[model samples]
Target: MKIPIRSECLPYALILSFLSIIFYFLNKYIAILMLILLAFVLFFFRDPERTIPFDEKSFLSPADGKVIDICEIEENEFFKSKAIKVSIFLSLFNIHVNRSPISGKVTYKKYRPGKYLPAFKSHASEINEKNIIGIENEYTKVLVSQITGFVARRIVCWSKIGDTLKQGERFGLIKFGSCTEIIMPIDTEIKVKIGDTVKGGLTVIGVIK
Candidate 1:
């Protein structure tokens, strides 16, 4: 069976595999190291299929990770009002692909270049290099931020403004370890809490109330 890897892995996989072959003739240790790295690259970019729940009233988690923080904050980017922000921290072992939390039209997309800090830090959400995507439907609007961590330097987003997406649809991914935050209206009923493990496109983050 073909491995379910993201298209983004092609470049990395090819480069690493080529280097491994070239170095094998010169140094076995170096070639073995390259092979190990190649395996990790393939593993990290794996995009397994998910069973998306068909629920119009619930919003799914945007990425796979642990919920690090959740708080009410003044959101001026999309909601322009009080919003509840749920932050998820992706470790090296977690899947980095981001998914649409709700079935909606992509209304807003912005990329801000900034510092690469540790994603677990509370302040990292404000200063880290990030891509912000807003999706809205007839019921409500939601914002997902893909933030780059110290080791995660690239944030990939395939979604564009005006694009329509279904709940749990793959929108983009963050290379390596990073952070993802979902900001919803204050009235949203949150379903998960801090330290809760969530799977992208599978775990419900909130319910529209």
Candidate 2:
């Protein structure tokens, strides 16, 4: 059986290959090292997984990885007040696609250019290059943040200012590996924890309202 790696590094691959040919005439060892690093980058950004199934009751995971944080964090955006935050960290080996956790309309969408930090760090959520999508449901508004990790340089988001989305829909893809955070209202109860492993679209991280 053949396994597939869903990474968008074809451009980098071509660029590296071209540079390798030029560097080969100057130094064979340096050229070989560059080739290896390029290969590692391509493999690290691999994306392999199915889209999370749609279910209103189940709050799906945004990225494929382990749940690192499921606590209350001070929300700065839509819910200017306090909120329960469920954070998922995606390593280089995990799938990089981001999916919607619930069905709702996007009330706010903003991309901030920031420094690239390790996804596992708590402060990285606020300082890393990220895309924030605020959604509103019948109960309350929820915000999903896609934070870029050290190696994951590109953050892709498909949500618009006034678009309606269904639960588990593919709204974005975090290039390479990163972290995803779901912020719920202060009154919302969190279901997952700091060390629990969660699968996107299947795990119930929290309930509505």
Candidate 3:
């Protein structure tokens, strides 16, 4: 099995492990606890390679988490029309990385600073601080938003406007705990539902007819 740890967490894990080593000289019990926490921090950021579906008509999930909601909304920012929004809520245990759902050129990218509401709340999608990426292919434009939660303070995006992204390619991640959203055209067929478990890059979220 190929275990790919996201490079972003190395500095954090190393720092915590180093502190644990120092704490060992002061108190063995505290040192042991810190070591255990370090292990979890490393695990939280683990980005394993997945067998993504090779389908040109399918849209994949952007983050590893549970499908908290599926709703229809007027997405005024990008689509400027009706769209089906699939929201995934990530806990501390879920992988924080985000991926591209389709192979397309990034046509729009925007970062909005706002409140850090709990990601589980449906309104977090609109009100929370977020990084929005819109990818466009010949058929349609898809928007993926990475939003901050109560605890998550950082949103990292690697793809910029005009960048070409292959399906299931890594684009960015939300630090600690957050939410990811994939907004597709209203007429698209959704493959997943509320409460369904999903894995980033591997799970198919919707299909274009």
Candidate with maximal TM-score: 1
Structural similarity to truth (TM-score) of each candidate = 0.98, 0.80, 0.96
lDDT of 3 by residue, 1-209 (tens): 77888888888888888989999999999999988988888888898877778678999999999999999999887899999999999999999899999999999999999999999997887799999999999977799999999999999999999999988999999998999999999999999989999998899999998
lDDT tens digits by residue: candidate 2, 30-141: 8998799788766765555565566565566766688887776777758889888888998877767777888889999999999998989989987999899988777567
lDDT comparing candidate 2 with the true structure: 0.79
Across 133-209, the per-residue lDDT of candidate 1 in tens digits comes to: 99999999899999999999999999999999999999999999999999998999999999999999999999999
Count backbone clashes in candidate 1: 0
Local distance difference test values of all predictions, in order: 0.95, 0.79, 0.92
- Model 3's alpha-carbon lDDT is 0.92
The number of clashing residue pairs in model 3 is 0
